[model samples]
Target: MTDEAALNALREAARLSPENLPLRRHLADQLLASGNLSQAETEYQAALGLSPGDHGIAIGLAEALVRQGKNEAALTALDPLLAMPEHPVRAGVLAAQAMLPVNRMAAAHWYRYSVARDPSQADPELAHRLGIGQPSAPPPSSTSPSPIPSGPAGLPAQPPSPAPAAPTQQPSPAPAQQPSLIPTAHSPSVVPAPHAQPQAAGGPYGSADVEPTAEVEHSPVTFADVAGMDTVKEALRMKLLLPTQQPELFAAYGKRAGGGVLLYGPPGAGKTHLARAAAGELGAAFVNVGLADILDMWTGSSERNLRATFAMARRNRPCVLFFDEVDALAARRSDMRQAHSRQIVNQFLAELDGVDEHANEGVLVLAATNAPWYIDAAFRRPGRFDQMVFVPPPDTVARAAMLSLMCRDKPQAKMDFDKVARATEGFVGADLKGLVDRAVEAKLHESIRAGRPIPLATGDLMTAAKTMRPTAVREWLGTARNYVLHANESGAWDELLPWLRDLR
Candidate 1:
């Protein structure tokens, strides 16, 4: 039969037997081949519903979405498959293709990740566009296995028919022709292939590399979402928020909106939340970077990653690049034995100082660290992380507010939050969440025994609070007290004094 006739036959078969997963997939594949993208997408969705977690069905669906320019939707479809322990090759390649237009660096990583695991999955042309594969090299000869088709505008084309099997099924042994995503004994690494492509100019990785770490997000979580820390809010508004809002006003006083603000406090004091809120309050793009995003076992990769991250922020002007556990990436070089570790810190400093081709004109860098004492001192200079804000445990009023907020969505009685807050003195935001969880869990048990639903009363929460310890807050306060006493020469820890006094 002709191709079109074959497709029609499959379509009729699928319509007659909707529950036949393989038939549905085959029809979707034929529909995809015939350029009926919408029909292909629908058929693929039907196949996925019949057999969810079927990798082939998911990839076909994602490919159809991408072909229709719904890159985000394609990614959403592929995310579960990507999250598997052994990343599916087609899923990874399709994800990389979807991400390329918006985020080339991330695309490169995903492409490398897939091709490393299964070399036959490599799409040399797509890799070349992403600046990770060899562009100058010739295409595969007629004698070799046909190259995976790069669909219209490089949307991931369908791969050679893959058995609709579990992702754990290993591929035939193929040459290890691509870069390795395998990490070293020390930390995760992205070891480049012998013919690894070069990063574009305009600084390391360039403006083209829009997303180096996590995707840049437009945060809607304003300071209002934050439970308390009114003082921290105010400080952030003045130091970070106001300048962005009234740039011309700040400029009159020889001040600029973009600079670094370091937030240090006990764990679960909402430091990360506050940074996100600051970005939201300004209505800017927020990029949250962590240690895993920056560190690589290979030499110079960490610095390159850091530089790429800054390049990404610079591209997204009025961006808030918030780094959590900043101390890990910016640890005291004096204490570091490894040269690579020190190089990472130096790269961090250069990026903060805008010492490279890319300037941080409108990018406000905010970082949070529980152990502020461990960060390199050079980061404290006037232009770097100059504004060190100390976030303290929430006061009684704040605790009450947090309790009410936590209970807002839970099934609970009209309980007095203030009494509970007063009783739980040293509990931080995390502790309060734990308290609510405990109360809900206990209520669940009670409901099970009574054979009915039970709403949590104030007494239930009080009992839960009593069972938990505020050791984290106590330990953080103790550490702050020591730093204030002996290391207050520069008075960086002076703002922490009141909290220390309260702790005593």
Candidate 2:
């Protein structure tokens, strides 16, 4: 087949398997080669989203952007990769090319620095434009001085070219003979990528091929920042926070600080926010892994992503690794028709168990799902999501607190939050926010008609809440009741019984 036909076939395949990162990247590479800059950019972005922080893919994306005369965009793409401690050589070259139009000196610095590292990529036009070397001059030999400056501050003074040696007789000086420039004003200092960490040798989840897309951050939100759920907060303090705070005391009783806690509730009920608060309370690194971060269309890649995610959390000790919508990743294997899907579930179980050399001594695993009943039974086993924490919808007091906070910034009259909270019974945090938004929107419309700004009041919120029902609560409670009634063998979900009874 012709090259065009092969490219078309690959394009169709990529379209069919949109989540296939390698295939998307290969197609992007082909598109770049074929000079389809726009299409290539799109595919590269998709692939980058799948396997974030891949240097090769980032460089390819920047190159494609630069070729399309989107120099600003290309520089944006390269900035993060260039900041990484270990980046590909091409990243520097592409960055130099992108920077040339805006800043010649910076471009020259990057070009010379890159070429100094590996001379084969030397470009005459770029070198000449940056005033580094003559366009007509022969490529530098190993013995020649590097065009890069001696230090970070200024350009190097060129010495006269050395006399040519015979084709194969001269001894070459090592590249290290030249002084390595410190990070310049344009190039930032060497820093490890957010997901980059040292891997343990031959460990099950220690492969460097996959870098977790989930960011490890020190959450600043404590229980004080969280609005309510006093019962849930107390439970978390005992189950997670207190143990970490008094590790020695807990250890004496044969209890370790780290374990898994599953937070299941209706969507937008502040499950994620609570997890972050737990991390903040412990002063731990929070790694929030979403469904998109783990699922991959390619075989084995999903498992690798999952392993790498757990590996990352392990490396960052005292980490609260919270997986949101985890039901998709750890669903019942018996119900899955695809072997790959079951493999992902199995991989998740193994990671939780910390199989082989991997240990979860200091890692606190937390997962949130709206449909916890869908997760595998094995996940509920001891040491792996053994604690089922039910996050119920906001109570009246919690709703009042939330309403007061949500309205703090808005122009308002003397608002009775309790009145509004009482009217919107069973509303979750997100539903309350939406009610506030609708009220503000109505106020805006009324203000326009009256030609004056109108302030929000208790009545405005109550009026808005009248039209909106507790949409997610009913559906979620319906499902939870069935599980609690029939599948509560281990009684992990016994706490949900009260909420389920309220549904009656």
Candidate 3:
């Protein structure tokens, strides 16, 4: 029979045999295959409600949630099944997959957990995606399996656990000494030593960052891929892209191909992504620097590490050194109590100053911080990060475009983009994403009740928007308004005043 005929027959069978669980599940599977997520979710929910303890049904429902991009919701659905010890490998695998984007290091731990339970269930792709693959050398044969050491969220910084003695065999003497000797750099000893002691800081891989790990990424995402922000794009074009495009024109005016830009905004305002886009548009290598990579407990290593990063960026030439959470590392030295913090700040300024104050010629130094007010003043000197770009929440145009971009892959119904945009005034790109996810959740419920596909509509989005608020913008503005009012000393916050005033 043709595909249409089969679907019709299944629907008829499901409707006629409302009591038949297999038919309902079959119908749900068919709907899922046809991209009818709303109805598929309904069928799965119904099947699950009928047979609450059925792991297969629960897995189906979780898979449906995942396919609809409700990963968190899928976790909620899988939680009950996870408690059962029967076939938790499936739940563990799915949870690990879901956690990858949110917390990659933690996901690696989960993958290890699942793999330990059943080595055959391991997924190399997941590890490869997270950049946490096995070392080239093979592991030494051991009769006993190692327990997966659990840690807190985000970065796993487990304190050294003494090896459990294997009753069946004598423990190797040498392997016991390895954990204490190694400073546990990349292995989640990420949280600094208590009281922030002066231990040797190293790269994420538990090795010195002096030579640094080879982690240069070529971003394919350009300014064109970024939604909205015409003003931001234009400023970047003039500051970086256009100069590179018309080198002679810039050279005639004694302008170099690169300089520095400080993207100061509320958190989740896409500062980091915009940095990537800038690198992509410039066709340069992107080297993302975080606090973990730079801060070492050892006194001079932090400075050395900081210099090495700049040196690497310079050698790469035409590289975008994007520093996330710049305020944390480059915070005002006076506010800092630790000598190391102050020294790191000094090193940061010196590196920005470079050899005889002209090192960062071809390198673009872009640092993003939610609290630009906390950034050191010396770093803002003309040749340094003079171009402070104020990235506010998405304006109307951006919100609309962001809505379209975020929901492009998902099966969306007739969504009024303009209406949604209007409803979400102060919402940033991430907030807009939340709005859509909330709407998807609401729509999923409605479909479950109606027992049919109900496309995501404007009303559903608007309803979700009414209950939601922009996360960082309101809070950031609350703090930023004070700076605008009191600390406009050098008029560094001059650009922020207009945007702040508009809110009032």
Candidate 4:
């Protein structure tokens, strides 16, 4: 093919398959070369979405941000590169940092260090502007210095006369009190200072002197406080509580190592509540690992945080590491673009594998993701999060239970919960709770308007329902059904499949 035709074909490939990182990167480079900054920025962002830590994509995005007068944002993007010990784009990153007004001190230090490391990088004009330049050594003094004499004590007692020091110079009133030749404790020395030596009984980094803050122990939320979800409660008892309480029986039955469980469904479906209840039932220490908590601006910090989280869980045996919004951190590896994300996923996988069934004892991993489809396939294997539980929206029975729990303390004039349940076909636990709250609020509003005591009635709830829409719709349910079906067929979560199907 001709060069022009090949270029056209490459562009077509990129446009047709934007999800492909390599193709996107190539097209982005081509667009940039052609001065199509807008298109190039989009392509770069697409590439980044696939591989978050791509240096080329990161640099491209940073440059785009700078061109848009978002210099601070550009610098923010380069912060991760700075944290990396040997980032390839160090020069470009330093240049970006130098451009930011708030990072002057750090930028100046980096520029000086970089120039010292490689003089070729030094730019006289830029150095002059930044008030940085090659440092000059001090010149030697012309006057001759006197030598010290050793005493019988073996210590330097007095300065030896420099052959009478040319009598003429000394004639000027022999300095009143000769300065001592001995150095003070604070003086610089070839040897390390006494205080500089490492101390025992201290933290390795010398942080022992600083007292740590008192740790606030987390209290697990119990099922009693969770207003409703009888079906969910029962499921937890049979599937989780029974297994945990009678491990000997489970082991004898050859079901001791079924792996972890994943609770996935629409948001606010009581997934977290069910997970907490399971933790309480198992009497396990609850560890909530949120994506926001693990993500850091520095490269490798995310992976480090992941390791630390697992280590903490291992240390606190019989613990439940509840990863909330798990998809944000554990999305499909095929969709991952950044090295940092890959490292984090790999560390997570390793830790998951390291959890010994016998050693872990009561320890369990409960991850909940609203977007289950986004979860990495590797994580869904038989030995990992093999039990994928679909915590679907409450059925009529669950809705009735929720309604009764919500309006128990309120004044309801013989409300038919069955009718209300039928009305809320697609409602999740949270949606039901919200409906009750809104009804109560509306009743209160009406009472205040009429200058009377709040008298909540069935009519008020019906009115609230008209204003409130169920959060989960047909499309969400369809997506969830597909995921559940896929998991069932793959035998990835056969242990939990029967219960999951019953929920559907």
Cα-lDDT of candidate 3: 0.71
lDDT digits (tens) for residues 475-495 of candidate 4: 566565665677556554343
Worst 10 contiguous positions by lDDT, candidate 4: 173-182
- In model 2, pairs of residues that clash are none
Give the clashing residue pairs of candidate 3, or none.
156-188, 157-188, 186-204, 186-206, 199-298
lDDT of 1: 0.75
Q: Can you write out model 1's per-residue Cα lDDT over 230-281, one digit (the tens) per residue?
A: 8778877776578777878998997766888899889998888888888898
What is candidate 2's TM-score against the reference? 0.57
Per-residue lDDT of 129 in model 1: 87
Clashes of 4: 7
Better of 2 and 4 by TM-score: 4
Q: Write one digit per residue (lDDT tens) for candidate 3, span 101-144.
A: 66566556555545555566667877688676532211234333
Worst 10 residues of 3 by lDDT: 173-182
Give each model's clash number.
0, 0, 5, 7
Better of 2 and 3 by TM-score: 3
Cα shift from native, residue 362, model 3 (Å): 2.1
Lowest-scoring 10 consecutive residues by lDDT in candidate 1? 173-182
